[model samples]
Target: MKIFKKNLVKMTMKMVGSLALFLGAMVIVPTSLVGSHQPKCPDELLK
Candidate 1:
């Protein structure tokens, strides 16, 4: 059982956690700054 444990497993878990945090910020912070710069469509919608 002891042999099953490894340092690489711990490091991999930490890396996955950090990557999740970075991805969360990417979706959240940008939306606040973007505000109302969205594009609008009209003529195409009528067809």
Candidate 2:
């Protein structure tokens, strides 16, 4: 019983860590690409 509980805790931690990493990448990649490749608008367009 103790071993099973330990294994379950380890698995849960691993799952949570991977989920957080995946979500971070999903958000960071698009924002980083947009920051690097955004196009400038003409001054007239802003007026």
Candidate 3:
């Protein structure tokens, strides 16, 4: 019973870590892409 409980806790932590990574990437990736792009402002405006 102790072994089973330890294994279950380990598995749950692994799953939660994976889910946090997935969610972090989902938020970070799109924001990074948007930040990297130049806006469509005219060259004259940039000068």
Candidate 4:
């Protein structure tokens, strides 16, 4: 019973960690891509 509980806890931790990682990548990837595609400011604007 103790071994089973330990395995369950390990599995739950792994699942939660993977889920957080997946969500973070999902959000960051699109924003990064969009930022990369955005047009630069005009030269006149820098003056």
Error of 3 at 43 (Å): 9.8
- The runs of at least 3 residues in candidate 2 whose Cα sits more than 4 Å from the true structure, single-residue gaps closed, are 38-47
Model 4 per-residue lDDT tens digits across residues 1-47: 99999999999999999999999999999999988886789999999
lDDT of 3: 0.97
Error of 2 at 10 (Å): 0.0
Cα misplacement distance, residue 47 of candidate 2 (Å) = 21
Off by over 4 Å in 1: 1-5, 35-47
Q: What is the C-alpha RMSD of each candidate to the true structure, in Å?
A: 4.9, 2.7, 2.5, 1.5
lDDT of 2 by residue, 1-47 (tens): 99999999999999999999999999999999889986889999999
lDDT (0-100) at residue 11 of candidate 3? 100
In candidate 1, clashing pairs total: 0
- List the candidates' TM-scores in order: 0.54, 0.74, 0.75, 0.75
Question: Candidate 4: worst 10 consecutive residues by lDDT?
Answer: 32-41
Instruction: Report the lDDT tens digits of candidate 1 across residue range 1-47.
Output: 55456677887899999999999999889987897676777888978
Instruction: Report, for every candidate in turn, its global Cα lDDT versus the true structure.
Output: 0.84, 0.97, 0.97, 0.97
lDDT computed for candidate 1: 0.84
Displacement of residue 18 (Cα, Å) in model 2 is 0.6
State the lDDT of candidate 3 residue by residue for 5-31, as single tens digits.
999999999999999999999999999
Q: Candidate 4: where is the Cα deviation over 4 Å?
A: none
